[model samples]
Target: MNTIKVFIVRENDGSYSSYMDEQANLPYGLVGEGATVAEAMDEWNRAYNDMKNLFEEEGKEFVEAQFSFAYDVPSFLLYYAGKLTFAGLSKLTGISAAQLSQYANGYRNPSPKTTQKIQNALHAFGNELSQLQLV
Candidate 1:
């Protein structure tokens, strides 16, 4: 099965949006909006299911693909804020807590390099946790 990339972003009003890029080259566009990430993702899945049903009813070909959801920098930071404090994340990523807070609040956007650094830090932390053994 093919994989479709879905991007999740936080809007200025503190709402969330999930959408597929135009470059997906699909027959139709998919989008969902909600007040939170989980709600947005649920709506996005509903959109896909609705489209699938429409194609089936019209006897059209429905593309079968999996979705890979990715969060933008601000969305990621905001979503994980509860589980990871800015001070903790600052230590993990070697970035200042204030700067991270600014990114989370949408006051500033991170450069591509800084974004990669954040991703790398999170992935490394995940890897370290995965290697843990509890007795």
Candidate 2:
């Protein structure tokens, strides 16, 4: 599966907007917006498929094939931060729960390094979970 980087941003009105980076070769100025990051991502997928189909109908090759998305930090946290307690996330990320809570609530933004750390920890946890087997 091809991986595409999608940068999702929260709008001032509390909705979310997303777009593919230039490297993805998607059309310029195409944006997807919705009430949540997931919804915005769904909108983006619909738009991408629509464009792909339109290009195909015109006998054009859409260079961008299937894609797996990579979401930005705020979008990722916004969607999932609520699912785990701040203490739980802190235990996994080595960040203080208060700081994690601040980041989750939009009271603070994590530095790039902190974001990377969090992402790496989450990926590691997911990998561990994937290794689970029923007794």
Candidate 3:
């Protein structure tokens, strides 16, 4: 079954805001901000539909894999894959090793192009792993 979640963040300054969206399964969008939690959920639903339609039109899988944006899965996968070191990724991405470290630490999300490179890196690494397994 597909599921969605809402989390609340209270800024240190005393403002309260809420974010609502489906996580890994969201093909449409990750929505943030709602006057109330209900409002946010409503917005997320609409945005999700819009995203789904757009991706569908483009013939792309908007939600091909459940990407856990705030997680260590990416880091662990890259480390265990032995395909790209932080330094290697930095060179490949033209993003410094520090930036790559930040990415691995879940401190930031990569820009679209960088994210594409990360995905591409994972794909290539997986292909290599498969070949090695057969050997």
What C-alpha lDDT, on a 0 to 100 scale, does residue 98 get in candidate 1? Answer: 98
Local distance difference test, per candidate? 0.92, 0.78, 0.54
- Give the TM-score (vs. native) of candidate 1: 0.92
Name the TM-score of candidate 2: 0.76
Worst 10 residues of 2 by lDDT: 21-30
**Candidate 3: residue 41 lDDT (0-100):** 47
lDDT per residue as tens, model 3, 1-135: 454454454333433234444444453445544554345446655666787788899989766332222213343333333556778666554668787777655677677787777667766867876888442
Provide the global lDDT of candidate 2 against the true structure: 0.78
Q: Which candidate should be chosen as best, given TM-score against the real structure? A: 1
Per candidate, the number of residue pairs that clash is 0, 0, 0
| lDDT ranking of the models | 1, 2, 3
The TM-score values for the models, in the order shown, are: 0.92, 0.76, 0.35
Question: Which digits, one per residue and each the tens of the lDDT, describe model 1 over residues 46-133?
Answer: 9999999999999999988788999999889988889999999999999999999999987899999999999999999999999999
Give the candidate number with the greatest lDDT.
1
User: In candidate 3, which residue pairs clash?
Assistant: none
